[model samples]
Target: MRLNHALPPDGANGKPVGKEGDLVVRDDELGALGNMAFDLHSQLSTTGDLARQNTFDAATQLFNDGLEAGSALTVLHDAWNTKLGTLKEACAHISNHLDYSKAQHAKDEHDIQTGMKNAAGKAMTVSRIYDYIK
Candidate 1:
């Protein structure tokens, strides 16, 4: 399966040569993904709490009335809560990891730029930079 058609094809020089050749990700993109994950986590937590509160009384009453469904409802509620917790944790992890990745990449770029300078504090030429990479 062609999973990623967006990637550029190799050029004659064995280097990627197309619009998507360079692996580029903007800070805003990472921030937006993180924000979305955080929003999903918040929404899930809020909805889960509201649903649990709305059902708690009914579940308790059914159990008090000694119905088989009460036991079933309690079990279902517990299972739903467990799944919801897992989902929330995953969303939190995604958000936190993205934030960390964005900051780390920025730092990496800064370090790379800083390193690409001569001892006299001049920026390295393109050919010189390519030589170092090669």
Candidate 2:
């Protein structure tokens, strides 16, 4: 007959077989990655600013030419400029969201620790009730 002890089994040499359902997250590493992405996008915005300005300056000069006022090329240039503006806005949003995520992750990690401590305390209190009842 086999007896079932409550404690988990240990591997060879009496070391505990690795914990089950453990989620080990390296938040510091993740936050650093997010910060790097944010910094890269900020640099991209600076470079894009100069490029956009040059592009618009050329487009305006072309549009100002009397021969091209009614040309389809002007319309195409305007559409492209609109799309570029939207793309820049999207990049800014991405950077902002990543910054927010990094802050939230830190908050979440703290909350998890607090919750675990509270749960352990409550479990110990409940376990003591059996001794009082006996």
Candidate 3:
């Protein structure tokens, strides 16, 4: 018996499919998102470091002048640094993962196309393709 792999326009669950179908990946968009994440990571690392240092210096000066608020400010600075570090790490992970995904997808597609070619280097027919899938 022939296998019917085609789904209806609305898909098996009756939900409308995307313009390019469910699994389409736009490489350019992925690259753009990755670049934005990398930029955020870089900005947070440099600017966040400068801001933290300035706040720490001010807090130290206040403490030296016998102000109680200096201790509170120091605590605030520490909390802010911890939050900033977490955000920077998340941005770095996103950037790195997207880059790896794009490269890996390209490699997978290359391997699949190479494997599907016949011994004579011609593309496999539709019937032969079904045999592999089955």
Candidate 4:
């Protein structure tokens, strides 16, 4: 719909004529007056930064951004959400693989160590028996 009226190009020397029944006085044109009203609200806000604000915090600015430049912020939001979900899933899968690898490695090491101990004990017993019989 009628997003911005822009003060009817501000006349010849960048001044509003302020005439009665002018196109600048239409419904959409009336919104330009809101910019002046919100200027006061901006000073009273808790957050100092202007870019990061909620819908209610800086409604005029938010609406202005939404209406500016044939805007398409919804696409940006959807892309961000999709990428975030993918990253989360990838991290979870990597964590699971890491846990499984550690468990398998520990089990393999334990088995190799147990086998070596058994072999050494048997070799020692056989050598002792051979010496005893000699």
Residue 105 shift from truth in candidate 1, angstroms: 0.5
- Return the clash pairs for model 3, or none: none
Q: What is the lDDT of candidate 3?
A: 0.85
Clash total of candidate 4? 0
Q: What is the lDDT of residue 20 in candidate 1?
A: 39
Residues 29-134 of candidate 3 have per-residue lDDT tens digits of 8899999999999999998888787899999999999999899999999999999999999999999999999898889878786678778988887688888889
Best by lDDT: 3
Return the clash pairs for model 4, or none. Answer: none
Model 4 accuracy (lDDT, Cα): 0.46
Give Cα distance to truth, residue 107, candidate 2, Å. 1.9
- Candidate 2, run of 10 with poorest lDDT: 1-10
Q: What is the lDDT of candidate 1?
A: 0.82
lDDT of 4 by residue, 1-134 (tens): 22233445545554334553344223333333444334433443423323333323344555576764223444444464566556555544554555555566668776664544233564334455456569
Error of 4 at 1 (Å): 66
User: Could you say which candidate leads in TM-score?
Assistant: 3
Taking all chains together, each candidate's TM-score versus the true structure is 0.71, 0.47, 0.72, 0.35
Task: Quote the lDDT for 128 in model 3.
Answer: 88
Worst 10 residues of 3 by lDDT: 14-23
lDDT of 2 by residue, 46-134 (tens): 76456555556665777677546435555765676677577766766765666677678779876664544233564334445455668
Q: Where does model 2 exceed 4 Å of error?
A: 1-25, 69-77, 116-134
